[model samples]
Target: MRWLCILFLAVLASGCTAAPGSNQTQGISQDKSQQGAGQATCAGYTFASAEREISVLAGPGNAIGNEHYQRLAQALDCLAKTVDAAKISSVRQQLDRLNPDVKSVSFSAVQREIEALYNAGNTIGPEHYAKLDSQLASLGQAGYDISALRQQLETVRPLAEKTATADNPAALKDLAAINKLPECNGQMLSDPPADLGDVQEISPLGNIGVPGHTLPTPHLYFHISAGRATTNTVPLLAPGNVTITSVTSSFDELGKIDEYSIGFALCKDVYGYFNHVKGLSAGLQQALDTVPCADFTDNPGNRCAKDLFYPVNAGTEIGRVGHLQGNF
Candidate 1:
């Protein structure tokens, strides 16, 4: 979570407002917030804050399926060449002819097999040799002469070192390939939504509380720019097929203005938020109004039935992609 904070500045609204002449000093109550806009009025919700509007630059759609497979293949190739079981069997046959004690035979066969694997370019690090040395010593205690096998092991150690050498270079290449994928590509301001033209001079994303700091920060959050902040009349379009998840409101105590925030469930574990949006279309607002304040806790107490949104065009809108917490 701290990493998330560092990479992306999460959503922040303008400020909170208490009901007029009401001094209640607690966060918004779940029961009242659950009522959403259906309640008698805004009177039910507390801690209403000012909501400021900002647009985000969305991230690219993650690569999946074939993309993942190709990446895996590349990674595998870099770390080690696949083992040749047929070649291994052939070497084992040669070692079997030595027909020494059971311990010596097994130990020598393993040592030669490690050499074969290295010669085949499988990833054999020094640790493999170190473990083989321990095993050979144990076998020696059992009266197996490992002298011949140990000499052969020493002969192949340099080649084994070479097998370990490829990994760093391979890893560098893998990193380069990964950086080109959509998931790894960083965010940038996007072209305007269909009806909206390009935007210019919107506020830079950063800590809302920070002073005079307006620069784009690294974030996984998906964003869509609604063109430049002209008359605040531009419509915020759905980046993709999505279900409205949560609707939040902010109020200005001094200005008596309210701001609305909308959350869209893009997919499982993928969510997006638009903050400080003004003048939501009636349909959009109604959709948001009905969304419940869910328990987003690690152990969720009351999880909402997230609506499904699909076929969302990549790069148009960005959703916040997150991983689950815990061991599999």
Candidate 2:
């Protein structure tokens, strides 16, 4: 969308706020003695320079593309290596406990209940329960076994309450219900631009400010439909040797969100936030190794959770978006 162009231009023209310890290497100079001795002097990266490079690679007629990805990989690889396998395992286990993937079956069942409730002429309160009971009996009498349906309704009761009254019907259908769970941490991104077999219509208002409103701080939308699709929770490799700050999941079922505006932090700002990553594609992994590493020891305080690690599963049949939070 043209908005993407506008957003990028705005970001380029007005650089984001710098994070603490962001410019640790600003005045750092390579000792000429080291050069004479053939020792390598480490240099740090800057968001402005990265943006400038992206703008140039974008060219006058195009937005950032493959070259940009290469640059991004190199940038991430440049960050310091703060975490090891143990740290990665810890982060992965924590994320697993949250289990952000919405159960499609549960979401679909709740959607049906909402529709049936609406059709049954009940809004909320005891009347709704009564109607549900009646429907359950009818199903049982028809040999359909209402027990499973009843359990599903019980599981989705809280969600149904919000969806029934939400102003944005399409946007709230499934997400409204799932966002309340402890796992989502009150940070559900947004409905997939496409229906996950729940959201009904796609009007202008529903799409406006959609995923943008749901974005948290310091995240990037790493849309990866063009990349390989797998059925597992794969590693979203560190662009550099940064630490593992925090890992989160995006609820874009079917990857229909395509692209959206998101708050972003420069790699420098997020440097050292996450540990070194594994399981990247062969090309990306190789690219990461070739990139110079950033020394974050000078910027320890600057390390924080400002990036979102979004990985899309091929089994979900959805395109993907990675939300990288900018330090700003």
Candidate 3:
């Protein structure tokens, strides 16, 4: 299944400066001074501290959590205001490598690795099982919650014992099927959700150096600015006839405002989501009221209604931007 995302936030302009090519120590001092001056330009910015936290988390054996990832995203947003474009690109590359959730490394790869390890001997002792369990744990920490996969793997002992051959063909085949799962892979949208005229800017799906977005953002960011000012007066329309499957409400610490992310299924095995929404349409609000909310684990004070069947027609306004300089 395919997914979509929309992040609503004001874009920050980048700044650059050249250091002197004289004495090495003096050049370092000048660079530090320049960086401090640049930081001063953005009030209440935490790019420096956030960068340091990311560095620590990226260190060997450090567990990277959702909070750390959020801080990294926020830091990158702040960094855009003071760092050069090239610097941002470099940081993105570094983050892409550090992030275990990068698309190039699929969650199926973990399953395949475990399958291969089991097939090698058609057995798993305590040590081998522990190692395999750690791998699954690491994948969970990376944000893909595959509790079902874990549960299946837990039956490895019995599955292995029933097999006569060294290669557990049936088990391996089952693992391979995960790659074809709708959530793992799906078709892209045939058309844009909104008309070009409706959106001020449309960011392609990929790495986005912005707040609330990870290194490799999976969703598009639509900017609906009023002239040069970032305002939330524009209406957010549905791309296709879809069922609103979920809605997440979170506190955006950076914006100091509450935001909503809506997830919908365009069709069977095709899904999309939008983030940073300030307000929900009346229909959505009614649906949201009907469902009991559960706490979102990624961030504190976040609530989510994960199961819903609210259907919306194509071109329907499901939400609106409701604040000045607020992210949708």
Candidate 4:
């Protein structure tokens, strides 16, 4: 509570974004040859420079009141709302006060100031608090003290029920149990099966360097192969070329341990070229578009059964030319 109040007060006082000006474009004329480039350059310079030039219009001696001055005024709207989450989950809650809202803010420096409020105050407005809760909830029930969490929620619920930032407790618990498994850290949680392939569990204490859990939030997406899986058997991919880029799930690293591992490989990294991605007779391409990865058991490989596999519903074909965007 103390930290939250401190962070919120800091945001209220900081002189941050540009003053509220017409977002509507101003007229600009240029030679046909330089038109596009000129506009881009102008937009960059004017937008960037005009920001600090604007005002916060503090009500008190040094305090600013304008929303435009603080990060909350300039955060980018999340356009990824429609992007297929598939194996991944996201919370719409407020972020740590130290973090930045890179999604909406043009200036990374400004955005960071906004993120400082991540877990700061849960009582300000429900929108911010709700997003924070939803994110933590997705961490799964492995190490969370549900009762304690609920107690905190009870306090928050009454004041901000109208603005939910967290997900339903029952939903979070169900997801955790579905993927529950013992690991070095504790229980490894799973992503409920998705239209795109879902992970059974992120292996704990995989190798010397690997951590006990895998979280998609930090972009560490991985999955362990359920059993023997391949393009032919799993119908997840057609055969062109296969190579693991990064593995998020782990069990053992030194010797071959096929039971728990998740590896990532972009289509562009696999096959040397792009096409309709007819490789997986199934919707694996579509799944790849969502997560584009498989569970890794060890450095050698992991098990993936046909049923456990989830292909991307829409994705691009891989090729030497690099990412050619399309959906199969």
Candidate 5:
């Protein structure tokens, strides 16, 4: 029942390697005049100045706390947007040289590896599982917060351990049979779900900013300017032919803001979801109305969702996210 969640953002599909654009204005003023002034200020930054700024933003030990990382990311983003491209590149090179031990690991990549192992628990022989498990255990020595990953491994451990401890011929035969089945090749996306130009910045995976994203989450954030979002000008297209499987609506009492999350199945094994969508399209809303939604609300926030099937073709306009940001 666990579906691999692919966080699609703007024009970049799951496997696409397009370089990120240089328009990042998240947590910054939206006024053109202010932006120009900021850019001018940033243009004069030297490597030393940039390093100081990063140190101040990152705090001691370069901790990946939500607020700390957000500030650091925003600062780097500002440099990318305002400073000369070469200057920014030089700054990164200098920083890397100064701290060679500071490696940038994508949490999503690790999560994917763990998920693959978990998914293949039955098929992967016990010896292979043990070897992989030992390798994963070594990741803790690298100072990563692998608590969540450890919990995930625990779910698959019992099955692997059972096979390792006993001479269950039936289990071995079942595993062989499962391995003989044809692989499930999911459908590839031919179109982007959203307009790339409309997106101010497509944040890298494992971003830490908002309260919901304390840890490095397996999500990509598409930041849009306030003006564009308020006008509901962004379109949420279907990247590929997919069946809408679930829709969740969340209402924040303090902010009094309402948002939606859409989950869909691209193929037999591949599934994806989008969060913080501003509004559902008319057709999607009608389909959602057919089912009774389950309430899973907390005080100051009300969340409800309905599970249903509503198929759409690639490039179909299913919804729009105009509420500042979209997470997938």
Candidate 6:
């Protein structure tokens, strides 16, 4: 479930009704509040301690499709290149593969070899000093491509991204091509409904204004986006042919309030990740637990016939997104 945020700041109205007989009996709350009104009643959203209205900005989560997947993957590659990413992945693999199987091979000896190789990632090292400085610098950005073609099967032989010599630079070119391959879109995770064989179990989770609301499907999307920065993850809502019904977007008060009515859903048997799944936080786990799921196939609960339930973790709790209890 996602948040349908509506900001109410400036135009909020206040009313002063008659107080009780005794002024002292009717305690005046000097506290000020900005209530949302002049439209559909505020859709359900908990208000924190009062101060001023906080801006709520959120959008549907999940990759739109192959197009979005490719774009996001390219963006990640762009970030990696900025950090000399291939060299970084290669050097780490080398250090990780430092085998101590050779008898009498001390950690210091392996450490020195690893360090020497790592230094080359930043500059032409003592071991590989024959190349011209400018040429060596030009070589690294593409030096990690290994195969003549993209999409080399790792099972055949690990697709290495480092070349042994400047004379041998296939690794560098191969790496560049591989990263650009359509199949290699580096989306955190992308599984389209088109990929499903049979999708069933669809239910509405009620309305948030005209456009914003939640739906339950047998297979829902699972994703997470969090850090110090405000993150948005709407894995459950896949992007496809959306049926628009109504929408509201205008500036009320000093903040912007936008709403939409989109009607579209996926085939159910909801697709999602468990708490133990990677890229989840403890708070996220708790949020997932609140969305109760039942085996409609064997035992359907007394929710409106349309409710789509999900499996809780081993602890027997329901699943949720971003840790909001129940479906939004």
Global lDDT scores for all candidate models: 0.36, 0.31, 0.54, 0.27, 0.55, 0.24
lDDT per residue for candidate 4 within 1-328, as digits (tens), equals: 9999999988877646334452322222224323432232322232223222322222122322334334322422221222223211221122222133222222233223223221111122355445445534543234443333333332223222421224544223222322332233321212221124433444232212212111111212223233233221112231222332211222122223311111222232121111111123223334435552222122222322111222222222221110111111
- Comparison by lDDT, 3 against 6, better one: 3
Task: Judge candidate 5 at residue 119 and give its lDDT.
Answer: 30
| Alpha-carbon runs more than 4 Å astray in model 5 | 1-183, 209-214, 226-233, 253-255, 296-299, 325-328
Question: Which structure among the candidates has the greatest TM-score?
Answer: 5
lDDT of 1 at 132: 71
TM-scores of the models, in the order given: 0.26, 0.17, 0.40, 0.16, 0.41, 0.13
- The number of the candidate with the highest lDDT is 5
Provide the lowest-lDDT 10-residue window in model 5: 117-126
- Tens digits of per-residue lDDT, candidate 6, 159-276, equal 1212123443433432333333234223232334211222222222231221111222212322232221222222222233211111111111111121111112122211122211
lDDT of 4 at 184: 31
Runs with alpha carbons beyond 4 Å of true place in candidate 4 = 1-33, 40-125, 137-151, 159-328
Model 2, span 97-146: residue lDDT tens? 32222111233454476444322212234445545655565556656645
Ranking by TM-score: 5, 3, 1, 2, 4, 6
Give the Å shift of residue 197 in candidate 3.
2.9
Model 1 alpha-carbon miss at residue 315, Å: 13
* Candidate 2 lDDT trough over 10 residues, lowest sum: 257-266
Tens digits of per-residue lDDT, candidate 5, 48-72, equal 4656765563455342344544444
For lDDT, candidate 1 versus 5, the one ahead is 5
**Backbone clash tally for model 1?**
13
Candidate with the larger TM-score of 2 and 4 = 2
**Compared with the true structure, what per-residue lDDT tens digits does model 3 show for residues 1-328?**
1222222221112112333554765878778756753573333444455455556655653445445555566667666766665666666555555654442335787777554432221223445555566677777878886664454344333322312234544333323322233462444454445555767666566634523232444445566664225444567778766666656575544445655766666555566566657678888888778766533343343444334567777888888653543333
